[model samples]
Target: MQQVYPQEPRPFVKWAGGKRQLLHELERNYPKKFDTYFEPFLGGGAVMFNLLAKHPDMKCHVSDLNSDLILTYVAIRDKVTEVIESLENHSKKYQKNTNFYYYHVRESEPTSQIEKVSKLIFLNKTCFNGLYRVNSKGKFNVPLGRYTNPNIVNKENLLTASRILQSSNLEFFCRDFETVLHDIKKGDFVYFDPPYQPVSNTANFTSYTSRNFTDDDLERLVNLAEKLDSIGCKVLLSNSKSKKVENSFSSSKWKIKEIQVNRAINSDSKKRTGHSEILVKNY
Candidate 1:
């Protein structure tokens, strides 16, 4: 496997709660070794890309409930050239009228896979704060960002990611996180980065999809983690530093640590940096 791209492959979209900032701490806590890797909450795949960069041939099973995100992965993995071309068209049209073109694409419902993926990337890049939020009706409702020049067509990163996806034995899914329980086996590593529990009343931004990841969902996730632990699967999880999260994994079987992280979504510069998140693992 020759490394063609000079840079490392990365996530194509700007996903909320993406782990790009926490990669170092995450690498430190990663299990010494495992047979395969599974990430049920595959937002912006920073951890997966980091692992794949080091071990290109590692078997990976990643999934997300956001169908559009999964479609972008599939499109890029299989049809990167087409996706690039479509994105270029978007880039051109966007320059002519940023606000109008952005909103038009946002309101559109493209039927083709390539079009849908390209539209998603365009919206992610041009949307406010690079945030992926939707209304209860499943419509992308984020307004246009203020970026004078957003990198809507990131060709180099996309190419690198596509090459990696083509070379690796990876599986992508658009399903509930709990579904992985049926396929996981002993010694497999599963890293869960579900939507963080809101620390404050004003911090609720879990609307990655139309279905918000609720408190009930978090409880189900805790149960799923325990089940994975009992099945002998190496499990790791990341979430906001909240009492609910801390108390849920308080059992003796888990190794809980608090790591500092920066919050990018907050509008206030004062509140944007120096936040704490919990990393729980069962080795």
Candidate 2:
């Protein structure tokens, strides 16, 4: 097999609130040397992918609570061919019965975790805006989007990601973010990108997947950052630069800096403008 290189170019999935733009800033602030990397709240994996592309030799440990999201990473790592085939089939089927899209989403149940993983990716590819949202009962509710050509699968990128994953002394798990603290030691770097505080009352979009990161969750994360800071491990976290958030970490030893990022989720495009976000770091 040909060795996969980090130079492989891949288009990112246009995810809501993705941080592809701020990756350079992250890289600039990241420590030049570290024993390992840990990303607990991996959303669309913009930071992780960028890190993998930049630091090909770095060992990584990544986790997320969403089973579907974690499975997509696993699928790319282990079952790329199967995932691509299923996505192509989904594209053909979706072209025919648009109504059946929601029908299958609500009714169909896969026998195994991988099958469910395939279904999740199928829906994510075809779903409106690539937004992952669920109803009160935790059912996917986003409608199909209008796109002439959707890269439902990217084989080369998937293969490259798998190769990077395989080469590292890596560990992937589906668990709560707080549990990750127990595994970190000195010289490790932890990057956190938890769901930001809602921009406004009507513009609330934090419900990415089923679990909501409440204020209490934010408090717990603050404690974790403090713990990591005390242990000599570098920690960098990002969140909305709201007054409440500032107060939440006001007493912490971490240094805070603000950066503006484009906000893409809103009914009116005019309202979807740049907003301030805080990058708390102890390096």
Candidate 3:
């Protein structure tokens, strides 16, 4: 299911701290040769799609703790046509009333896996600025977007993504990041894009889903990287360039490189700018 000339690349959803800009840098740092590719965080799948575009023959394994995100990938891989159709229907049903949209989104239920996947894609497409924010009760809480003609669904791109996914010997799972180590072997490449340590106490945005990756989780990730490095696997990780983060991984083996990344989540336009982030690698 390889396309001779795949269509222009696009991300399926808007993810906070998505790595669209870091793709090229990641490609450069990634080893030229590796047995398999694994990404544990898998937010918006920017890296996975970039890898598929560049290396069609490479085996890939991707997982995410968020079931909704994994379901979106599964939908793209298995039910592209149906999911696109459902997204279009959802876009048409969107009303100007914010409360109406919020309750409609909050009240909807899916009977099957496909329907559940469709609901996620629908909410993601119509939510405010495509933000995936949730309440303490685990309900989708993002408001309605003000776009007159949002590309709620891109059938061609989704179809192209489906073909790209089909070409590679890839596996998708919804699990904790720690589970990824079980499948990684020697000479494999593992890219970690965990929720970064916030730059300041007030800047914490680790709550991508209901669960938050805390400081302890970040330490655990460092340990995993050290273990992978010990076994001869190449590991690269990205996190906010904070003193706390630097102190956490300030050891002999991990090399840190600072890179600028856009910060678009803040309300203040000035604050919604680019800043430095650390790219920790075991070279």
TM-score winner among the candidates? 1
Looking at model 1, the pairs that clash are none
lDDT by residue (tens digit), candidate 2, 213-262: 88898889988888888889988889888787788778757688998777
Better of 1 and 2 by TM-score: 1
**Candidate 3 segments whose C-alpha is farther than 4 A from its true place:** 1-5, 95-99
TM-score ranking, best first? 1, 3, 2
- Per-residue error for 42 in candidate 3, Å, reads 0.5
Stretches of candidate 2 off by over 4 Å are: 1-15
lDDT per residue as tens, model 1, 38-106: 999998999988988887788899999999999898899999999999999999999999888998898
Please write out the lDDT profile of model 3 over residues 152-242, one tens digit for every residue: 6777888888877776488899998888788899999999998878877688777777878887888888788888988989888888898
**C-alpha displacement of 214 in model 1, angstroms?**
1.2
Clashing pairs in 2: none
After superposition, candidate 1 runs with Cα above 4 Å error: 1-6
Q: Work out the TM-score per prediction.
A: 0.97, 0.90, 0.92
